[model samples]
Target: MSLPPADTAPAPEKGGDDLATLAKGGRTNTMGFVIRLVARIPFLVIATRLYGAEALGRFASALVLIEIVALICSLGEKRGLAQRLSEGAGENRSAEVNLVYDGMLLALGYSAIAALLLLAFPEPMFPNGTNSPYDLWLVATIPAFAVTEILLAAQAYRFDIATTVRTRAIVEPWTISIAAGLFFYLPGTRDAGLALAFITSIYAGLLTALWPFLRTYGLPRDWRPAPRAMLGMSASAFPLVGADAIERGTRLLDIFILGLFAPPQAVGIYYAAQQIASLPQKLKTSFEPILSPVITKNLRIGNMEAIAAQVRQVGFWIIAVQLGIALVLAIPGEAVMGLWGPDYVAGTATLAFLLAAEVVASMAVVSESVLVYIARKRNLAISVGIIALQAGLTVALIMAARNAGFGDGYQAAGAAGALMLALAASSLVKALLLKHLLGAPVSNWRWPLVYAAGAAVVVGYAFTFLPEWIELVVGIPAVLATYALVIWRRGFDEGDKVLFRKNVVPAPDASSPS
Candidate 1:
């Protein structure tokens, strides 16, 4: 399929229009996050209550390797594809489509090699040992997961985020939850329900993404695999791949290390907390697909100030929302974890720290979205350093907890604390570098955030005096409402309010339209 030619020329200023586009994407993804949160609770409950902590821990251990490998196999196309599509816009009708196909081919080749290697030497995947033979089949999902990433990236290049929402937010979570339930009931699949469910959901997401991708870009016309072009593409993608991998590594490395150093029960507790915390992380990452294309377009026009503005705007949105979520969940941390099961209630501190980690990491995430296009090597270096710091901190903290004669819960919290510190450091360093490069102040911090958080905490603390169920039911909404109202009134200006406004029509000129 041939893509329609895009205008590559430097067009007139449309800052509002760009923000509106971003706002639209944000609105869609925010809704997606809510849906995902709802769908995910059941899986967590089932995994914790039914499968038990040891089983869930083993599953998580395997997943860390599988997902990281799959992400690497994607060759950084999740964000890189947007730049490629932008740069190749006007070259030819088939140029853009063929570039996507090239990425798909390369990703497939990488996934195939990775899958086979893991299949032969399966020890790495199951550091704690496999749950069942079905766990080995997870190798097959690597290709599908990588391909889905590229496909979603292709759609995002066309400013289509609904497809991503459908695949990731709706289809994948629901499929996994339902499949996990069904597979658990079947005697033959009971031991491997989580693994099988995960595989099923990944393939379902792949199909969901593929449908829209084909409808949008179709099959590439006269597309032949070119060794030289693909090699160049791979070479160019190295920095992006490193940045992407390291950023993801920071999130998963703690779990991997825990699987090695701590008991499976400890890892399971940590994994549960991490999953709940990752909900807000989704808000930041979901913006990346839309943010990349916008940043790329502005970079093409040398709109450095515009890029800074977008980063600041989006960064604020992410941090604000993440902070609210962290407060809500963390304030009622024990109750939230207890819902999973009594065993998971021990992870309350871990849950709070992980949620805070997501909040602090918001700035770094938004900064990297621009840095990847502007200073790929520098960005990659920073990411590597950050992950290294996180690793060292995680091991040190976990050992310290153990030496102090603490239990597994304390050990998990130590890991979570390390992650929070590392992410805070990343946010500081990356935000500074982005400001230097853009020659403009790029900050998401606002005083109103402090006021809002304080207000929410006070309100939430009052609820903690009541029953746990009351804290969850009545307190959560109260905290969120107080924070939302305060932030809306104090933090959001007319421009910032654009994120919530559905259709922002510019005012007509007095001398013309009026």
Candidate 2:
């Protein structure tokens, strides 16, 4: 909850404060992305091999449910915790520390309630629990999961994303993999490894994630918040949590419905595609910790223009990079999946569709970041409505496909693909609405995005002329290099070069205000 003093004796951020802040987040995010990019391959191998298709599918399904429960625990306080705690540290450290305590205690209380609700309605969660006893432990992880997230949010308020990246991107996934490896030698069933690995990683990640935050911003003291204050905070946060839950809920709802209509193995197959698409989202998430605080601080000073500029710069960068990734994946998608196993290549089409949705949602990412400060309720409302509609539509589509005599695999794929489309439509709408709300202009893709998409296609087609193994080695990198070269020439400015030593921006005159 402590704020770094205004006169921290840092150099003046150039290209305006907003642009400087965006550059900072980009640096942190890029570093975090590297960690994830390194971790992902091993993770895919461990998870797919340990759990196989059926159990992996169930794990994926359960994760979606776990996310819903965790949202119940978030109850909307983390966002406010950051904003309020940051405000209090500036104006009143006493109150700020109290607010931090309140946020944690509030999360604990909500998590307790959420746990009870999950226990109380296990049937709805997993009607056929006989096969998945370990799910009970996974469900019990809600409190730890939720509390960990709140504390993490508190850290992000400090503009410290390294802790988050290490815990989430590095430690958590690695821990899960290691645990799976150990459990592979366990005396019990193979299925037990997935559940055990998940639960163990959640707690381990929580412990590791807290170290830096506690080191920099020690534990909050008695500064207990009043019941009324807690209520107000929770109320404000509920919609925000609901909005996130709905988004996550819709993603999982397809698998849940598929569980009832299709074979469990098909659900697992679809989840493979989900995991592949999630890579870009993980990269996008790394920036939020660094960006959110900057955005909120600018808003506090009524710097709307600064906020808009920052959002546009970061949004476009994220979209551009993710677009390049989507292009590479979409081009050699089957080969990429085949690297996992030949059988998993069935998800190639689904990966293409989902990654496309992620591309469109990149605009929504920046817009939502700004909306958190200007008008969260407006953003939450739109997200909730869209997610709900998407869920209902997914169910209807799946049922219709089934009734029309389609196979379970076909219907399941259709529902997931439809959900991806819905997310795309809703994300675009959110981006447009947020643009109006923030009065930020929709960024016209100046370069690389357009050029990269075209290059990806050409490179992808080029791969077909070669053998699979050779294409795997050359085609992917060729497309990536093409995008990178284009972006360097056509997109990045001199400061980016100076930072990464790609280009040298001339030093500013000593008399200049910078």
Candidate 3:
């Protein structure tokens, strides 16, 4: 395929690289979160209204396997692609296009192999007895979903996060929502409609990601399919791939293992809580694609201080937003879960645990972003051990809960508790390790988080006496504003304001690095 000319975008803003990228990513991801929140309501409504919890649980089970495959096939290019391109460009090497092509080639091959395996051996893929012809048909979306990830990563490397927001935050979820709505009206398709809707969304996202990707990064030029070289590249990404899988897989592991022990209703309810918690998780991740290139550039120049400041600043920002979002979401979690149906309201405790897990885990994710570049193998090892701990804890806790005469809801609560404990342990270990390596604090534990939490409880409890609808509508915003005001007054400085695009401050002296 013929390729367009090389990227010729102007230089990033002077003295504002870190703040600029952070500000831009935060804006786009915040908007994306809003779009996703709006889009998810309809999808959840359709699934719960038509298919109910059992069917949704079965769907969640199958999706876990597909997503695991997609994450592996992606080979960590969600961040790795930007790292490679930034390093290549910094060295004045004309290999950015080749790097992009190579990464895509690896993802396609890996995903195709995974899809074929799922198609060939459907039994292992769906051990939950929800296996169907339609489910098998949807396995073909694996490659499309994985490749689109690389395309979006390529766009992110070009500083075009709008494509990611448009495709992931909008096109994908909205398509599934609309398709599920349409399919719900059809007879005999209730069970399979969600699966089909998910497939449609994946391909839609793929097509949508392609045009903007081509416009920005262009096609591969003189790209020969080098099997040996691609394999080597994939080998280099193995640690990254493993880390990403372990990081993402921990969230899904609960559902998969819970399915082995509990019923689909339990899995469905837990999945609902997981969905709610993952929204705040998006705020932290929105920083990753933008942070990767900047971190890579800084690392090359041996700018450890700047890297340290970057980590601390981003970590603080994530914690600030994550805590506030957590408070608002978790405080009215029962009402939030009730939106799906009254049956899901029992997941209130699970939602709280999941939200706390995300809040604590944000520190670990920011720390890992730095560790992945500096001590990749060590970071991968930590991630593997952490997930192993989570899996073991989840199984042990669930079994103990069952034996102790706890109801199914409490049993699932045990699972969430296990997950939160595991994540907290992982965060502590990661923070200490990263701290020792950098000789600086990686996470900012300011007084505002404590004060904000206390205030949120006081405000949230008082509002709970009102109707659930009024409590959620009025209380959520009130809690958010209260938390933000406290954090703004105490936790943030002028630099933090610049990072959030709140105010223009004179740039720091160039003579003093970071």
Cα lDDT of candidate 2 equals: 0.69
Q: 267-330 in candidate 3: lDDT tens per residue?
A: 8888878887888888778888877877877777777667677777788888888899889988
Tens digit per residue, CA lDDT, model 1, 1-514: 3444333223223766677778888999999999999989888988888899999999999999899999999999999998888887565647878899999999999999999999999998888988999999999999999999999998888888899999999999999989999999998999999999999999999999988777777778888899998999999999989988898888899999999899999999999999999999998898998888888888988988888888888889999999999999999999999998888888999999999999999999999998898899999988888899999999999999999999889999999999999999999999999999999988999999999999999999999999998999999999999999999999888777877888776432110110
Number of the top lDDT candidate: 1
Candidate 1 positional error at 346, Å: 0.8
**C-alpha RMSD values across all candidates:** 3.2, 3.7, 2.2
Q: Pick the candidate with the highest TM-score.
A: 1
Residue 511 local lDDT, model 3:
13
Local distance difference test values of all predictions, in order:
0.90, 0.69, 0.81
Off by over 4 Å in 3: 1-15, 89-94, 502-514
Model 1 deviation from native, Cα RMSD in Å: 3.2
Q: Which should have the higher TM-score, number 2 or number 3?
A: 3
Worst window of 10 by summed lDDT in candidate 2: 3-12
Clashes of each: 1, 2, 0
Q: How high a TM-score does candidate 3 get?
A: 0.95
TM for candidate 1 is 0.96
